[model samples]
Target: MKKIFVLDTNVLLQDPNAIYAFEDNEVVIPAIVLEEIDNKKRNADELGRNARQISRMMDGLRNQGRLFEGIDLPNGGRLKVELNHRSFAKLQETFAEGTNDNRILAVALNYHMEEQENPNPRPVVMVSKDTLVRIKADVLGLTAQDYLTDRIVNMPDMYMGYLTIHAHPSVIDEFYTYRYLNVNSLHLAYPLNPHEFVILKDEMGTSKSALLKVNADGKKLEPLFLSNDPIWGIGARNAQQRMALELLLNDEIPIVTLTGKAGTGKTLLTLAAGLLKVEDERKYKKLLIARPVVPMGKDIGYLPGEKEEKLRPWMQPIYDNLEYLFDTKKAGDIEKILAGLGSIQVEALTYIRGRSIPGQFIIIDEAQNLSKHEVKTIVSRVGEGSKIVLLGDPEQIDHPYLDASSNGLTYVVERFKAQNISGHITLERGERSHLAQLAADLL
Candidate 1:
C-alpha cells in the first residue's frame, strides 16, 4: 500500500530533490515548511542555496497544477502542499511553543489521526532531519523517520582505503626483493580497489612487512611512490601516513581523498605534497587551498577587513600548517613569504564556483562539511593538468545536514574507488602528540 510522508523544512533544505526521492509515496509539504524555506532562501550559504532550489522546484510543480490539491509526480508519486494544518488540542500544551517544528508536527498529527480513523489507513510517516522533532513525533503517537536517501555507507562498513593481509613468507621476501608482487598471490579478503593500500605481513609470524599500493591496473601491488624522501620538509611518520603521501604525491591520480581522526596529519600531508608539486617539481602553476566555511555553532557574523582578513580565523589551520612547512619563526613571516612567491592562493570555497581552475594543485580541507552536490561542483571545476585533493575527518563533520557516512568526503571515496584517476587513504595513527592521540582515541 502507498504511504504518506510529511516533510520537515530541514529535509528539503538538506536535499532539495528529496520530494522525488520517496518514489510513488505521497509526499506532503506542510505550509510551514514553505514559510521556513522562504525565510532561508535569501541567506548566503549552502542552506540558502538549497532553499532557493526548493522554492524554484515547488514553483515549477505549481505550474503543472494546483499544489494544495494533490498533483501527480513523474514517478507515479503524489505531491501536495498542506496549508490547512493548525495547532490543536494537546499540540499546544505538549510542545509549549508554536515554533515551526511544532507546526510541522501538527500537520503530521492531523494526518496521523485521520489515518487512525480510516478503515484501511495508509501509513503517515513524518520525515525530518531534526532529532528532537522525530522524538516529539513519537510522543504525539506519530511515526517519524530520518530522511536517509543521502546515506551511502554505514559507519562500521565505511571504506578505510586500506586493509591488511597475511602473505606467505616467500611472497613477502619476493615483494621486498622485486618491489612488486602479483595481487592474486596475497589472497586478500576482497578485491582491492585501484590505488588502495595494502599492508603485506609475513604469514609465518615475522614482524617484517611491506606497505604496498595496488597499481592502477589492480593487477599488482608495488612499493609506495614516495615514502623515504620528505616533501616540503615533512615526511610520513606512520604506515598510513606513508600511504597518504603516496596518493598525494602521485600526479597520475588527479583526485585523492584522505580520511582520519584529528591529529592524523591529513591536512599536513596534503599541504606538504601540494608544496612539493607546486614549488619543487614546478608541476603546477599554483597551489590553491580552499575549505567550506561552515561554522560549528553560532556564526560570528561578518568581520571587518579585506578577503584575507575575513578568512584569517577560518583559514588559520591552513596557515598553521603552511607556516610549519616554511619554518617561519616570526609573525607575518609566512604571509611575507606567500606574498613574495605570489603562487599560493588560500580562498574560501564560496568563490570557487563558475570558475575553471587549471594547472594548479587544489586542496580542499574540511571537505566532510560539503554535500554531494557541493563536492561535485568543486571536482567539476578542476581543469586540465590540475589535481584536486579532498582532505577531511569524516567523524568530525560540522555541517548540520551531513554526518560521517553521508558527507561528500565519504561519497567521493566510495564513488571514485573504482576509478584509476582517483586514490584514497585513511590515516589511522595520530602524530600530533601523545596526549592528542589519547584524546582522539578516548574522547
Candidate 2:
C-alpha cells in the first residue's frame, strides 16, 4: 500500500532533493516548512544554498497544478502543500508552544487521524533529521524515520582499506623475494580493490609477514614505495599509518582519504606529505589546506578579527602540526615561517566553492562534517596536476544532519575505492601520545 510521508524542515534542509526520494508515495509538506526554508534562504552557508535550491524546486512544481489540492509528481507520487492542518488543537495540551516543529507535528497528526477514519487508510510517517523531533513524533503515535537516501555505509561494515590474509609461508617468502605477487595467488572469494593494502601472514602463525598494496591494475600486490623513510621529520608509527604515507606521497594518486580516531596522525601525515610535495619535490605549486567550519558544543558566536584571523581558530590544528614539522620554538615563529615560505595557504572550506585549483596539493581537514554535496563541490574544484587529501574521523562527526554512515568523507572513500586515481586508509592506532590514546579508547 502507498504510504503518506510528512517532511520536516530539517529534512529538506539536509537534502534539497528529498521531495523526490519517497518514490510514488504521497508527500505532504506542511506550510510551516516553507516559512523555515524562507528564513534560511538568505544565509551564506550550505544550509542557505540548500534552502534556495528547495525554493526553486517548489516554485517549478507550482506550474504543474494547485499544490494545496495535490499535484502529480514525476515519480507517480502526489505532492501537496497542507494548508488546513495548521491548527494546533491536537497538540495544545501536550505541547503548549506552537513552534514550527509542533506545527509540523500537527500536520502529521491530522493526517493520521484522517487515515484512521477512512476505510482505505494509508500509513502516515514523519521524516526528519532531528532526534528530538522523531521522539516527539513517536510520543504522538506517528511513525518517524531519518532521511537515509544519502547514507553510504554503516559504521561496522565501513571499509578499513586493508585486510590481513593468512597465506602459506612460501607465499610470504615469494612476495619478499619478488617484491610483487599476483592477486590470484590468494585464491580469495572477493577481488581486492585498487590500492587496497594487504598484510600477508604466515599460515603457521609465525611472525613472518609482508606488507603490500594492490596495484592500480587490481591484479598484482606490490611493496610500499616509502616504508621507513620520514617525511618532513614525521614517520609512520604503525602499519596503517605506513599505508597512509604510501598513498599520500604517491604523485600518481590524485586523491587520498584518511580516517581514524582523535590522534591516529591523519592530519599530521597529510600535512607532512603535502609540505614535502610542495616544498621539496616542487611537484605542486602550492599547498592549500581547508576544513569545514562546524563548531563543537555550544557556538561562541561571531569571532572578532580579519579574514585570516577569523580562520586561525578553526585552522589552529593545522598550524600545530606545521609547527611540529617546522620545529618552531617561539610563539609567532610558525607565522613567520609561513610568511617566508609563501607556498602554503590555509583557509575555510567556504571559500573553495567555485574556484579552479591546479598544480596544488590540497588537504581537507575534519572532512567528516561535510555533506556529500559539499564534498562533491570541493572535489570538482580540483584542476589538473593537483592532489586532494580528505582526512577525518567518521566517528567524530559534528554536522547536525550527518553521522558516521552518511558523512562525505566515508562517502568519497567508498565511491572512489575502485578507481586507480584514488586511495584510502583507515588508521587503527592512536600515535599522538599514550595519555591521548587511552582517553580516546576509555573516555
Q: Which number leads on lDDT?
A: 2
**Per-residue lDDT value at 405 in model 2:** 92
User: Which digits, one per residue and each the tens of the lDDT, describe model 1 over residues 1-443?
Assistant: 99999999999998899999989999999998999999989876778888999999989998889999999999999999999764466588788787888888988898888888999999999899889999999998888999888888888888888988877888889998888998888766578889988887887899988888899989999888664788777888988888888888888999999988899999999998998888989999999999888832223346888778888999999999999999999999999999999999998887777689999999999999988888988999999999999998989987888888888889999999989999888888999999999999999
- Per TM-score, the best of the predicted structures is 2
For model 2, the local distance difference test gives 0.90
Which regions of candidate 2 are displaced past 4 Å? 295-302
Clash statistics: count for each candidate:
0, 0
lDDT of 2 by residue, 315-363 (tens): 8999999999999999999999899999999988877779999999999
